[model samples]
Target chain A: MKALEQKILTDGIVLSDTILKVDTFLNHQMDPLLMKQIGEEFAARFQHKEITKVLTIESSGIAPAIMAALQLEVPMIFARKRKSLTLQDGLLTSNVYSFTKQEETEISVAKKFLTEDDHILIIDDFLANGQAALGLLHIVEQAGATAAGIGIVIEKAFQDGGERLRERGIQVESLARIESLQDGKVQFVKETRRVEV
Target chain B: MKALEQKILTDGIVLSDTILKVDTFLNHQMDPLLMKQIGEEFAARFQHKEITKVLTIESSGIAPAIMAALQLEVPMIFARKRKSLTLQDGLLTSNVYSFTKQEETEISVAKKFLTEDDHILIIDDFLANGQAALGLLHIVEQAGATAAGIGIVIEKAFQDGGERLRERGIQVESLARIESLQDGKVQFVKETRRVEV
Candidate 1:
């Protein structure tokens, strides 16, 4: 976790007061060693939940989520994002709104992958406004599965997404929690509090 | 590699004569153990290339590519796909046509991540028409980098993609080479040949 926070500070770019770009390492171009470490941290944190599946959105979340799934010795399922509303049967679908792109995209997973007997662990790269996490949670509910916990690589704590999930009694664990990106300076949360679900 | 071949025969669904759906273990719902094995296999095959980086497209390719990168102890960069032509500066972009989806999408990588000194290993889940690999090779060329080789999880040898790449003297190592999908049965290539590039 410290390595991730340090990497974020050293390589992450702060474009504005609210926007942080981690294309150098985390999302676009990835450091596999760091991703492996992240996976280990997530696995160690939520090892008690008895997670059966690791769920994440496609593209950005695949690297970290897959690594975590490998560490957890479970399967990783990534929800495919579709711009057009081509709804298909036997698929669990949810719409997620991206604040940066300012567009609504539908994320879907096959129904056969999830069942009531499964325990799901949701993972993502960034937890801003919690739209993606919420959408995944909705799909998990649709499958009649149990939500074990949510693991995030980076959380914009200044935003209300983390708070919202915690309000719903969800265990949200983030490696690096950004308190603020004000004035082009990166500020991290001084302390992390765990919410027992 | 034998494990991968067995998995395909057991779980891979032949949706049609031209399409094989591997969502059960390769793409949508991923088996991390198999993915790790795949990573080890790719790393072993391309280990002599002195690969400085591992590259792939977004979503499906991320899992295997990152695993290979981890095994190789290098960085992994996934090209971002864009439907709209944003045309951002400081980015290497290439257009890839998806035969399955019947659409053309632009895949972009940050120019800073790739350099002339880097030896890249391109990894992907499938090598069908090789449009994605071609696009990635173009990006690597634009960056003045050397493409050591390509590691494909499954190669549709019946298609011209693998042939086209091999014709150009590119080293393409595919774990499973499917010769045909006739009558909903998967037929693998009788013998595998290594093209010395």
Candidate 2:
């Protein structure tokens, strides 16, 4: 994850102590080559789980998840976000509260896409409070599918989301983990050197 | 485009005369291999344009756009959709009306991502009413960027979007052009066999 960490240092904008904007090459505008590499890295890391599908939230997660799915030779499914729930049938739904947006949104996936036979790898762009990952995990559980692991591009380690999932014994792998973003500087965790760049 | 056409006939659900649900592989639950093929197809079609960037709207458009960008070795930018505009500066914004959802959503891109020297290839999942394409074209124009061409996965030729763009002398390449969707059957435009699968 050295390239990603380096890109964050070079292009990432520190909007505030709690907000890091990587619109240049991560989310709003993206680098397809970097995304492909990120996907390869995720696939390499989770290749042992025998993943049948890649699951992620809409918009941001689709890029890496699609690429990883391609590398893993599996299907990729993005859970759709809805502002209002209409009580649809044959849909697995979960509620997520975004601390950044300060709003509650419902995420859903078609039940036919997931089954007891599938092992899913959940992927996302940012893991701050881990609400989005939790919501995706909930949908995966509802379908009777096994969550192989969670792949995150960037994780705010100062927050409790990553720790919460780890506490549940869920395998969480974040490519870039931020130790702190205080004083307009991004501080990555120094001790964990096992993750490849 | 035979593979795409065949996939549409096999997995695509023709909901009505105007709506075709391709969530099985094109949007919601996507096949990565098919999507990779789609990206390659788009890249081949627009290879002669010297495209500096690939552009598209968020969510559905990201998959194809990213793949095309990867093949083309360029950056991809997805316009962010906003239900309510916050009047932000340094953004190229346009209004797009979704005929399916029957709502007006403002789409915007960061000003720095696009430039006058850039030759952009606009990619999208569908070309139904062409409102989304029009909005993207407007943003390109605002940035003083030249649009090399527009690449669409499926074009509802029964609709007026394709005609409108062609009327403006824009080079539009649609992988699958539908002649009709009558009696719950998907009918592709028969004459244009120039597009390779």
Candidate 3:
């Protein structure tokens, strides 16, 4: 977690008050070494839970989710944004609104991949409005699977998404929580309340 | 490779004459252990190359790319289909046509991540029409980067993509090359001729 927080401080750029671009190390251009550390942290944090599968949306979440799955010794399921020719007719579909793209797109997972007996841990790169996480949660619910927990690389704490999930009593763990980005400076929540692992 | 072949024979579904769905372990719901095996195989094959970075498109490609990067101990850069709010402005963009989706989509990578000094290895989940690989190659060219090789999990031998890239003298290493999918039987190319490693 410290390594990730350090990497974000060194390489991450604040594009605006609302957008934090960690593309140099996190999403677009990934640092596999740092990713491994983040994966280990997530594994340590969620070690007690029964994680049958690691669920994530495509593009950004694949790297960390795959790393976590490897550490957790579980399989990873990535929800496809668009339906491909190879995908079968039976699928678990959910519509998710992208806060950035300003579009509502249907994210889907093949029906056979997820079952009611599975316990899923959702992972993603960024948690801003939490639409992506919510969509993945919806997919898990549709499959009658248990949502073990949610792991995030970075969370925009100023946003209501994280708070909203917490209000629902869902266990969420993030490596770095940014309280705010004021004048190109990132503020983190003080270690006043310890996160129960 | 044997493990991968076995997985394909067992879990891979032949949806139709041209489609082979291995979503249970490859793309949608990924088996991390198998994915690690795939990464090790790719690393062993391309170990001699001076791979400074691993390049891939987002979604399906991210898992294998990350695994390959971890094995290779190099940075991994994934081109995003849609630029999210967190993505930087200056990016090397290319148009990729998806045969499955029957549409053309724009993919981009941040310009800062890749450079002329970097030697890249492009990895992908599938190589059908090679539009995605071609698009990635275009981005590498835009960055003036040298493409060391191209690695694919599965290559449809009937498709012209692999043939076209090989015609241009690009080193393409496909783990499993399906010659044909006739009558729900997946046939791989005979290992008589040595495939370029």
Per-residue lDDT of candidate 1, residues A36-131 (tens digit): 999999999989999999999998899999999999999999999963222255799999998877899989998999999999999999998999
Predicted complexes: DockQ each: 0.63, 0.61, 0.78
Better of 2 and 3 by lDDT: 2
Encode model 1's per-residue lDDT on B145-168: one tens digit a residue: 999999999999889999888887
Deviation of model 3 at A138, angstroms: 1.6
lDDT of each model, Cα atoms only? 0.90, 0.90, 0.87
Error of 3 at B152 (Å): 0.7
DockQ of 3: 0.78
- Candidate 1 all-Cα RMSD: 2.0
> What value does the lDDT take at residue A2 in candidate 1?
85
lDDT of 2 by residue, A1-197 (tens): 89999999999988788889898898888999999999999999999999999999988899999999999999999998973222246789999998776788889998999999999999999999999999999999999999999999999999999888777777788989999999999999995543422
> Which prediction has more favorable TM-score, 1 or 2?
1
State the weakest 10-residue window (summed lDDT) of model 1 chain A.
A82-91
Docking tier of model 2: it is medium
Candidate 3 lDDT over residue span A1-197, tens digit each: 67887888888888789888787788778998888888888888888898889999987888888889999999999999868777748989999998888899999998877789998999998898899999999999999999898999999989987876676777899889999898998787776233654
Winning candidate number (lDDT): 1
C-alpha positional error of residue A34 in candidate 1 after TM-score superposition, expressed in Å: 0.7
Q: Which ten residues in a row have the lowest lDDT in candidate 3 chain A?
A: A188-197
Per-model TM-score of chain A alone? 0.95, 0.94, 0.96
